[model samples]
Target: MPISDFRKKKLLYVFNVFFDVNQSGTIDRKDFELAIEKICSLRGWPSGSPQYTKTFDSMITIWEGLKKRADSNKDGQVSVEEWASMWDEYAKNPDNALEWQTQYLRFMFELEDASGDGTIDVDEFTSVCSCYGLDVAECRLAYQRMAEGKQEVTYDQFVALWKQFFTSENPSDPGNFIFGKTKF
Candidate 1:
């Protein structure tokens, strides 16, 4: 099953914020590359080093996926309009939607699990959630539910949570906690 329109849009909105690294009101492959470069620099990764290949490759893979799917104009880039409107097209096709969701989860986990520990700590969780414009305090509470008393969320746990978040419509599910409290 595909996620609800509201939930799916919320996911896209968060990703749009993260991908638009330059705040240029658009997102493209260059933005993903720049984001990786900055992230590597901040982590003290050496220039021209191979240590950052996994991170860089993951971003490139995601960019390719987005371009192949969401670049409606075939213009070799994804505009804000294309990002926002792609879900409307994907939602009508459950198989395509699920494929995107699964692939997206893999990409996001690779990005957020910065320590290569196969888990996301609170700080990482908070940083990812912030992109969605979700309040920090509310995210704090939601993190607890998602973490389920653990200090971090493992890839398996994250996958289960994402599956629920993507496919379930019930508000009571912890997956609904992805963005914390939704304000009208």
Candidate 2:
């Protein structure tokens, strides 16, 4: 089956609200730079600090990978159609996910685990969501759903949900809240 409308909307949230950091209609190098700036700012990683430099480099690497996979037209931007289509292909054959895709997932999980305790607590989840311009209250609820009554989410559990976020079509899947609740 093709990508579901449900999945598409979630992907749009990522594309429009997350990756398109400059409110641009397409994903490009600038967006990645802005995102790096935001993340570093949120963490108070001053310029020239190890954290800042690492984040800047990591985001650029991720941008290169995303551009390779989604910039089919080679127009220097990844349009919404290309973004959704690339993900649609991944949804169909999740086991074939590229290293970059898994790398992105790991990066996001590490980003949200602010305490660095190997698990994500509700507070940590809400804080990162806020950094990304997501609704904190809604994020709290989403975190609860994702944690499934647990006090924290382990990296292993997060990896499982990450797969669900990409591959599952079920609306009730907790992984739908990976980035925050999707508008139905």
Candidate 3:
């Protein structure tokens, strides 16, 4: 089955905010490369450093896995339709998408949890969003809604939100704010 319009909107937010870094209207290896560079830069990992090397390798592995799973037409790029279709499947049978999704989620959690304290505070969430060029104020509000007045969100909590972001189409789901504001 195809994804609902609401679900597609949420998925598009994730795609545009994270995957389609180059704004190329499609997801490809270049987007993943740019993502690695952006993330490494945000973490202050100089290109020759071990951190940069490990991040680069991990991102490449993620890209390879995404392309293999989502690039259904063998076109070397994932179009919007392809992305929507992939998520549709993920929404149905999560295990089919678990491996790459888990890796990606861990990477994102690490990026957002700047203090390395195994949890993400509202400040860290806002800071990461600000670094990503999102509005800090809006990010704070979104975090409030996502955390439901909690001071911090642990990795397991974030994992639940991540799952909701991928699987739920309900308008009230807090996971919709996982990427900050959504269109609907």
Candidate 4:
């Protein structure tokens, strides 16, 4: 599928966040989350919410996916140098939307998995919202609903949810986008 204008804008914002933190075109896990948090704060997201939790989960999912292709050093963590290498590889072939989305999902997961504990906490949840310009309370409600039947959203589930939120035919439906805004 062709990339939507909204998705392009969202991806560009994400890229800008990456560049802002990894100005040298490199990023460690901490740097990555910090950048996301900064972006979320700029976007006016509340300090806590289910939406934030979902965002955090999404970051982790993104990192996990990227880990497959970018963790060439086998260090179990993405270092700044490794990120530079990965970014180069991505830039060389930026047209692959699926790859880009997968990488993004993993990045989201990493953001949520603060403390490197492989699980999300309240603070991490708030921090993720602070990066995505979301309202904490509103996000929490959404996250609660999304996670109601499941303890955690898996990678594939994350992708499906993200696609529904960002690329669905009816973006205006609050039932569609995780955060409610159609344009991301």
Report the C-alpha lDDT of model 2 over 1-184, residue by residue, as the tens digit: 6677878888888888889889879999999898888898889999999988888888888889999999999999999999999988888877788777888888899899988899999998888887887788889989988888789999999988988887777878888787866444
* Pairs of residues at least 3 apart in sequence or in different chains that clash in candidate 3: none
C-alpha positional error of residue 119 in candidate 3 after TM-score superposition, expressed in Å: 0.3
Error of 3 at 60 (Å): 0.9
- Per-residue alpha-carbon lDDT of model 4 for 73-116, expressed as tens digits? 77666554454455445434544444645566566656555656
When 2 and 4 are scored with lDDT, the better candidate is 2
lDDT of 3 at 80: 85
TM-score of 1: 0.70
Could you tell me which 10 consecutive residues in candidate 1 have the lowest summed lDDT?
Answer: 175-184
TM-score of model 4 (CA atoms): 0.41
Error of 3 at 7 (Å): 0.5
- Residue 26, model 4, lDDT: 40
Q: How accurate is candidate 2 locally (lDDT)?
A: 0.86
Q: Against the true structure, whose lDDT is highest?
A: 2
Sorted on TM-score, highest at the top, how do the candidates line up? Answer: 2, 3, 1, 4
Per-prediction TM-score to the true structure, in the order listed = 0.70, 0.96, 0.94, 0.41
TM-score of 2: 0.96
Where is the poorest 10-residue window by lDDT in model 2? 175-184
Ranking by lDDT: 2, 3, 1, 4
Task: Give the candidate number with the greatest TM-score.
Answer: 2
